[model samples]
Target: MMFKTDKQTLTDLNVLDWNSASLLRFFDHTLTLGGRDQLYNYLMHPLTTIEEIVERQETIAYLSTVNVSKLFDKYMMVDLERYLNKPAAPSVKNRTSYFLDTISFNFFSLSAQREQLLVRQSVREIAMLFTALQDIVAEAKSSGKAVGLLRIYADFFSANASVFDKEEMRQVGRGKSWRLTTHKYNYLFRGKRRPQVQELFNMIYTLDALTAVAKMWNEGGLCFPRVNTNDTAAALLRIEGLYNLALDNPVKNDIHIPSAQNIWFLTGANMTGKSTLLKSIGICIHLAHVGFPVPAQSMETILFKGLMTSINLLDNIGSGYSHFYAEVMRLKTMGEIMTVDNPVVIMLDEIFKGTNYQDAYEATLNFINSISGIESSLFFVSTHITDLGEIVGMDSCVALKHLETKADPKQGAIFTYKLLDGIATEKLGMWFLNRESVFETFRAVQPRKSSS
Candidate 1:
């Protein structure tokens, strides 16, 4: 099964983008371009099955315990990749053919000699890379850590045993007999064993990507989430100490969403961390689906078919849709998605904020009531309209939650950035306005009279 998610959801969670603080950027420590591309592919298409996710998690966990830094270098890998991708030259038949070609290339054709030189350099790099991988495999086997993905890689080396022979590679490294040996190995690698060489390159790139993720796991102290496979019971997502990875020092919050109480009616004062909380939850869910370690102490969740978020939704000016209309369309999209039987996670940060208070309140209230009946999915709808809390509070399926904030005489509104039960009653919009002296600024700036 493929995991479902749209561009808007990814953008809302900052999962992948050109931004420096994107989740992809945070985990992208790859050395080679191939490794980076593989990492990008992994983030773009998250795994759906529990078995696949667990296997990837195990691979990353195993990698975290090993030293992969010595196996690859950026420049050497780049050169080897380039050389392998280039078209192979015509094969030399025998010693006579190689001798003639070498004489002709050296004396008559500068380009041919340069090409041969480049081929020799590429061969040398490949030999070095094979030697490095062989050493790593030897160490892993000696230490009895060659299992799982490592074992698979080791088996590949074994299958191509002649290609990574210790004495032969050492000979290739020393440049003992350049003309015959270089052309021979080059033909063997780039011509006869092209497919195997390509496969080896792919494996190394994948290992590089996984090793980067493992490094992130070690540095960030991230943990692999427990994917609950019990389908007999209701779906649940329980995350403890969840925080946004984009923030340097983010305040952690715990979240619980059971199928029994699927809808979370979130309310809070402006800028009190409601949107941040929603983004953090969305990011964790996304990372968990990708089989990457999440920025949380612990997490347990049933597999979800999709995850959608409308945190920073924008209006379609070119399409002639107002902000309110766009918001309605987004919700309509979510409603259609919820029609499916599979479970999903939907997050709407400050829904209906583009419209007037009365319309927003009525729409939010009705929407909450409608989605609350969706027991298959989880809903997190945040709103500035605290009045709807009273009506939604009555629904047993809706969990009333808010980011806690306190008012201080000296400090004004003190944002705790903490998630707590119950709705926020304080209206701090006017307090913020007064604090910023907006009214005073307006009064101070009088309209200029036209000179007649």
Candidate 2:
């Protein structure tokens, strides 16, 4: 993830903008609320699909907003399915079943073949039992009778409750011809498939675990981890402050940072808060969605999975890799984790800042197009490249405000660092032109490449 550009606060949100002052407190709050070890699963959930690099950047920017130690309570669809004990997408069924098998096997004492069969059988029995119970429920409801738990089980099968009909639910399975049950027949052969008297015990146990898993999801996602943030209210308040900024700032030409979604193609003068704006919005969102207060006195938003970045990883000692090459690889890695359907907050600072103009422009174009379709928490990017802004269409731009500077024509160019309206035509940083003599400097002499 790219770091933030903090001109004001030196806290943790300023990794270009992480303000560390309230960082620990923020994490403590998350931990307090999200529960134990749930943080690990929360972090890994985003890896399910990184649709593009741009979302990854925004994702990082969003991360700078939250307390890592504290847990955010938002749940993704897949997580919801798992928690509800519904099937995940068909693409992931085999994996889910494998995981289920492992859990069931480890928690029980069956041999490998036995384990597989037992799970299958249990699932079949459960399904049959479900249908039978439904039928019984209907009959009782239609008649003048109201069936209690035990009475229903006893009515459906001979073996039911003196206390509760719970045991009877299992006994009915013994009467079911294994050959007739196609759904869970394997389980019977896998384990002891005799008609046990305490059928309700097994039924209740399996049903309870299954139901709990849907609420909690797997060992990780099925259920929410505990939240342990030390101070939820304080962290929420800081978040509120950013909302205040968002509500306060309205237009780029006028410079009000409005609510926006993923992969923004930003271009502006150096001091326009392009970078700072990115963090401000990021902080605001992290605060608002996590149920913390926003920067603004009032806040509004939907919760997100997590945040990621690809902004500052650029300042490597010449990248030790080709600019376009590295950019491509980084984006590929990001796409693996960023999902288009879910929200990811990304921030890119002068992406391709190291590549030739042509390649940089092309890469940026592709990046923007890729994430334009995904939902997001925030997407902030900064650049001096005008074509990117123009080609992208500024009116549709997310963070396109410029830092309009007034030149003191008489006393050299003094930078105010104050942001202004409209896109900037000239950034005063030009004086540093020859800082790294790119043969654009004195002498048309090309760097002498050695001949073999």
Off by over 4 Å in 1: 91-108, 138-144, 162-167, 173-179, 230-235, 447-452
lDDT of each: 0.83, 0.41
Candidate 2's displacement at residue 261, Å, is 7.5
| Minimal lDDT window, size 10, model 2 | 221-230
Q: What are the candidates' C-alpha RMSDs?
A: 2.8, 16.9
Q: Taking the tens digit of each residue's C-alpha lDDT, what string does model 1 give over 260-286?
A: 898999999888999999998888888
What digit string (tens of lDDT, one per residue) describes model 2 on residues 255-358? Answer: 23333423455556555456655555555544333222223434334334445555545333465666556666656655665643234555566677778888
Task: Tell me how far candidate 2 lies from the true structure as C-alpha RMSD in angstroms.
Answer: 16.9
Give stretches of model 2 more than 4 Å off.
Answer: 1-22, 25-263, 294-297, 314-326, 373-377, 394-399, 409-421, 432-452
- lDDT at 59 for candidate 2? 30
**Candidate 2: deviation at residue 5, Å?**
19
